[model samples]
Target: MWEVMSDPQSSLALPVTRLTRRKTLDQVTAECQSHDLKRTLTATQLTLLGVGATIGAGIYVMTGEAAADYAGPAVLVSFVIAALACLFTAFSYGELSSTLPVAGSAYSYAYVSIGEGAAWTVGWLLLLEYGISCAAVASGLSGYATSLLSDLGVHVPAALSQSTFQTVLSGANLTLTVGPRLDFVGGLAVMIVTALLVRGVQESARVNAVIVVIKVGVLFVFVGFGLQAMHAAYWHPFIPQSEGGFRYGLPGVFRAASIIFFAYVGFEAVSTAAAEARNPRRDVPIGIVLSLVICTAVYILVASVLIGIVPYRELGVADPLAIAVNAMHEPWLALLIKVGATVGLCSVLLGLLYGQTRIFFSMSRDGLIPAAFSRVHPTLRTPWIGTILLGILVAIATATMPLEVISDLVSIGTACAFGIVNFTVIWQRNTRPGITRPFSVPLGGITIGGFWIGIAPALGIAFCVIMTLPLCIDLLRALGNGNPLPAILLGIYIVIGIATYFAYGRSHSRMAQAPFDAD
Candidate 1:
């Protein structure tokens, strides 16, 4: 065992051997069949799960910030653009999930179509996408919770509700300064969601479904009242001219689209639950596409109402929707909206935490991580260890860091993962022509000189790459402005992942021991 552990071949082999090693479809299917997670999720439940994941604190909070800082009344256009990008990527995800129908979402798809190294990289990115996303959403939830409590004549002390560094905006200039505080509310919210997740998947799904109904219903109410009260003059200069670069012009629209793209993060989480899905081939695709459609429509309507009823300049608060409701002088409705935002954020936290645990579970089972992470509760059948540990880490993050910092990191990570998934679909179609894809991406038969071209995946790749540019710019801007902490932290994470692969995962992978026989 020590010889195997210390083998020089094991250390050097990861670059060549692991990169060439691909998990066969048969092996993936066998693992899915043998996995301990119960198949209890139906198409309806899955759809709600996607909605529960997608429509969260982002819509409730970021819509205002995006509108005020970037797109103005054209925020609706930004939402449409982001939705279109997500739609393209969702189609590719639909095809892959239908074909693979395993846990780990893109990570599992990459393992089969790409290779071990690519799979590990995608898994590492997913940890950022789902785990940090939970932290960001939990922090957002804390703000809404505070507002709700304030309405009930209870106020949280500033020292217990805010971050150490406070960001203050003046005109187009932003400043960050030291103002130490601990976000106990955010930490508590994560802990509560984590406890609920460890109890079981089915129970969590049920709770998520209920939360989806409440939040969606509240959004409809907002639309109903907002349209009635909208003043056409507020939207006069729809795409307000930019005072400077990336501020309320076409550039701002695209930038806002990239920023608000975080709103669509949850649809991919649906695919992560494929192993627990009752009819993965049919239901997973339906869940992915249907949820995107539902959420996009809601987002467009909500953004329009928000800017129509309240000018875009005034919409840049933590609870934008509630603030819009409050402007109408309907105290009861404002309370209801506040409640919806809080519940909505809780559901998002739950879905992300669930996806994060499943990703770790799949990687661990493949021997890329510790086996203890893969252990499912005997009766509950959930990856309790990973779930608890991730929850603790997220709690600490939410309690310490500001929302914007965590959210920006999540956007970059999610975009990279989406780009990889889109490329994986194109690669799989080109290399494995005969593989059975239960749901093939539409418009793939435009043959040009004996070669087939898939339009959807191609568009998917373009859109994902386009959305990532703004995030990269934001990262650079942050670094240039002396806010290098998030970038440094993300770099450290990637380095650790690469180091772990070389030191342990490379030698221990099940595929390294016995390569999958495609036949």
Candidate 2:
């Protein structure tokens, strides 16, 4: 949370009033006064937006892998665990979105409920979460793109599948390695998302709607068809201990939950879309909770069906969906699923990019980032520059970096965000009770304060830290000296944020000395 720097003489941002900004959090929220875009969405549209964001890429790929690895047929339990955690955080998010409907999504909410420092931290982490998610989805799209090319008997060398520093091309000499291919397809997907968003919010939301429907339909078909082939015996030992189940009890489930947390990443994307939402007060809450329920149900059913049809060990880490279908002797079905998966992943990329741009928009408007980045397109009504620039950066990273590293890193960042959100909710309920709150946690409104909000996040952070330890030790051992790269990156971002805070946000913040910017 931000420490309020005392400034007796302060010039607040324009057109805001009433609530005095004696703190950094108040100053960060001044842009609610300068909202250029008007509400154009309905509650159902908001709910669909959540669905559109949640149920795409993860369902296609991650479910099968999670099923095979941690819970065997019981990976359904893992999905349940993830959903439970999300429900708790969504409660906090929904309450905030209704109370403060703006472009910032969680970052904006954080600024209002927590402080400028927390908002900055969430904004920076959001870059890693949503940005990396978009890149990962783009890469997944490339897998389909390459396979489609192969189908047409025009296979680009795998080396040319993406872009990156992998292939050493010295003019007339091309040395191919297992690095980045020329991921032209991933580039195409990014361009498509960029163009759609540039068109307008309604246009982008509608496109996302269509994508969500088709993707959800594909999942339904897979589950229904795959169910017919399920053997009850396959679920013989439901939690299938020796058959890929955990010997160490809940540890296996928790580990799986941590990894499976990746699937839940984009569900929060809906909360970020609250800016374009017509009825954020009503719809934001409905959209977040409903979409999560739908995704969780689909996830549980799919995981159950996979283990019933195939042995856990046979279901390898790579391409478990295709492997499961193949094991059922349905080559035609397998081929079809690949097509569906590739297409569905496009929506995931788009949704993730949408989330990233909005978070950037929130930060820029708050003076946490450059003011230039806060400019909404006079026509598009979106943060076009932030969208396009971030896209280019992601294109370069995913095009070149290996999938495994990207996947793992994204998981870490996303999990951290979840922990913070959970804690932020509890903090607001307990510490900042004077603020407006339209929705709330049920009961222990004391217990929630005590256990769910307070204790859960503290432990969640500890768990994430423990997971990070292995990575830290590995990096240190690999270099034989603790690599300064990670520390340096963290420090640089923090320093930049501190500079931005003091330079612009400190003095000119409407909330600094005057009221809010409700202009």
Candidate 3:
């Protein structure tokens, strides 16, 4: 990996345009900038941003599902495998944070360092990863809300909560259908996050930190209470039946790794907050690894308790934790867990939205998308337009959908981006000898950071691409007679991105037009 960049200066991005020196880009460009988003986040605030952006239905709900359907009590091992994989990739991120410390996460880094086309495509993918993924998160939050309401004596009417088809079917059986409703809770959370982010990164991060505390507190409560009911029997035969011998003499860990992979979603968010960090070199790496480690530890521990309390067969379902508590004859605890889930999801939605808007901000700045999107509001200092646009779209998704499709899509998208980060770090390491590094791998012997992060990306891309083809074929076949517009729209999104880059971004790109100069 270290051999790839022997003479970076020869191939490195010489400043494309001589905009100015010793002047932060935001200040010089602020006047022309499309958005008013402020940069006030500190290291701690960024850490909380990492924390807030991290958890959601993945842990509270998906854990049991993994245990039951995929891994069983050995799901804890699955969590470990996934965490270790992320740990590897995060190290590469730590290296990049020290070197580039820019916003746009990996996309921005790729653009300025790699070339115009790479940046544009990565930026497009980041949108799918962060923006669409957040929408997916909001949808997941809505599902959790329904489960919470059911725990209480009061339940939502089916017409409000269930999908139109589910409601129709249930109504045929009984006079009324009980269902999960779509309150604006998911949408409202996005709004609140937008407001905070609008206020400034510093303030928003502080608020996010507080929310993270609550979310973590909720997880802890579950862990502590759930631990009381733990039984070791669940740990027997950790690796269940599998197709081949792999990873641990059984492919179970790999299978578990894929299913539990989404649990580690928030790790990349540190890269997103790179611009606001005081010391990107130092803090970005620290925050990324620190947060990933802490979260992984928590996940494994909590998973252990979840399995200990229940058998593997019963753990694999949506909202597994609540379902587990329901089994303990402590339905009331499940109710609280349900309510806690609602609160935890609040932080998840807000954090994911915060990340989504920033990606657009970077893309707009780079001239990838319409420069109009980069504009800041004069008074609010936030990207009000972009925030509102994303908010509405995500809100609608939350109102009318299930978590399955979106969740898988997000995981696949995220994995693709993750793979890129790993390779980029390796590319930089081999080429840029003088590249400044703020943080390095916690263990610096051989560079494994690239490989660790690369696995998920590999797995994600392979799986998603594989999965997408079948879905597309089915969708086209099923909807040929009906409105088939959604399928058509998805095709247009990518085409529009490629078209926009060629039509506009290419001409305006600093790399293409400006001369090299050290900033």
Candidate 4:
């Protein structure tokens, strides 16, 4: 006999269990074993994937500007702070990915520990995180690519090379101004990566690994060459006094940390590759932790050398690293850095696009979205349709939008998803104590009110929340002063997400067909 429960909130007699349904660990593991994504990714490839994603525009482009505008020499401290926050979240991810070994990353973990609704919410946030982030990276890539071309005597018209819109803040009001330009270069870049992704995961990983080597080598060359020109006097005002708000001071360091938190966002890309990892249990955790550790080291070393070689105030340009390389009196090195950045961003695009497609693949398998997203190509064994569709949407957005204005929104979305991952660890510990965890978060916790909250996850949640504060405060300040565009856009996205869930997902969810399994 099947046991049933009532849904007091619904008139359609939908079972109450469907509203708060949790997928069993056994089910998730079984699905991973049977998934269509080819298990071709090795530990090295996965680590490089994480590196490829994490090391792009953030270090090459944002670092110098962050130091100049917000943190000064203290941006090194800012990187450490952001890395610590991601470290906690990465630890939580390591444990869960090893346990579940599923495609959706945080969304899949949420489905197993929390309810389906929360899983959908996490998936929605991930869409915002990875999708918009890909567009933003492509937009940044356009700048480097266009510059590199001009250096070679090849010129692209500004109308075909620039974004169609710009976000401006005048006094208190925020306005979006249209322009007669289109980012064809960025759009073409997105399509090229999309084509590579559709070919197969292994092929994309190989390309990404090669690009990673080139960029990492480029950065190392800068560090090695720039060290001899170090000016210790540049380090005197380590912590610049506050110039009001988060402009320059200790507050500015935290503010800079919030912005550069985007740098650490892609470390979780390792978890998203779980379904394709050859040995997901061991490899996923290794990839997640190792990539973060390496990238953080690189960020700190590069920032230290950059500040030593050049005054922080001069780093606010689009090419901070190039400026530092020029300061080394090595124009050749500057050219190399620009070329590396241009090639390097393709790997970032590859990793992010791969993550986004796989996440939707997982969601589609769960029946939350259309089944077309999960359909695997017969020859390539890749989710071709979804990959192409998402790539097109992102490319269009990259061409049309002024992504700089909404980049922090990606940071906020990532932190929210990461917080949920940490929370899932705590929740799973309490609810499914007997389940085998191939890896576990370090720093065990005591039972608090009958719920065991691991120290790592607790701090992970706290760190994510703390990192999110400065960004949220900035958004609120903009809203209070008269700019409502960002808040309005976020609200619209949430409303559409809710409407989609209730209109289609709630009724069509796979859990709706299965009996509640308390065991």
Candidate 1 Cα misplacement greater than 4 A, ranges? 1-14, 163-180, 445-451, 481-483, 516-519
77-194 per-residue lDDT for model 1 (tens digits): 8898888888988999999998888988999998988788889989989988898788888888888899889989999998888766666655534566776688889899999989
Worst 10 residues of 1 by lDDT: 1-10
In the range 447-518, model 3's lDDT, one tens digit per residue, is 464433234333433443432343344445535645344444456667887787667776675434333323
* Candidate 4 minimal-lDDT segment of 10 residues: 1-10
- The list of candidate 3 runs beyond 4 A from truth reads 1-37, 149-155, 162-185, 243-249, 401-403, 442-512, 515-519
TM-score of every model? 0.92, 0.81, 0.77, 0.96
lDDT of 4 at 25: 70
Please give the clash total of every predicted structure, in order: 0, 13, 22, 0
> lDDT at 41 for candidate 2?
70
Clashes of 3: 22
So what's the TM-score on candidate 2? Answer: 0.81
Model 4 ranges off by over 4 Å: 1-19, 517-519
Candidate 4, residues 1-519, lDDT tens digits: the string is 124444345545343456568787778878987877789999999999999999998898789888999999999999999999999999999999988999999999988887887899999999988998999999999999999999999999999888899788898877888989999999999999999999999999999999999999998988899889999999979999889999989989998998899988888889999999999999999999999999999999988999999899999988888888877888888799998999989999998999999999999999999998999998899999999999999999999999887878888988899999999999888987888788899999989789898999999999899889998999899889888888887888889999999999988888777754433
What is the C-alpha lDDT profile of model 2 across 253-282, one tens digit per residue? Answer: 554565577777777887887767877778
Clashing pairs in 1: none
Candidate with the greatest lDDT versus the true structure: 4
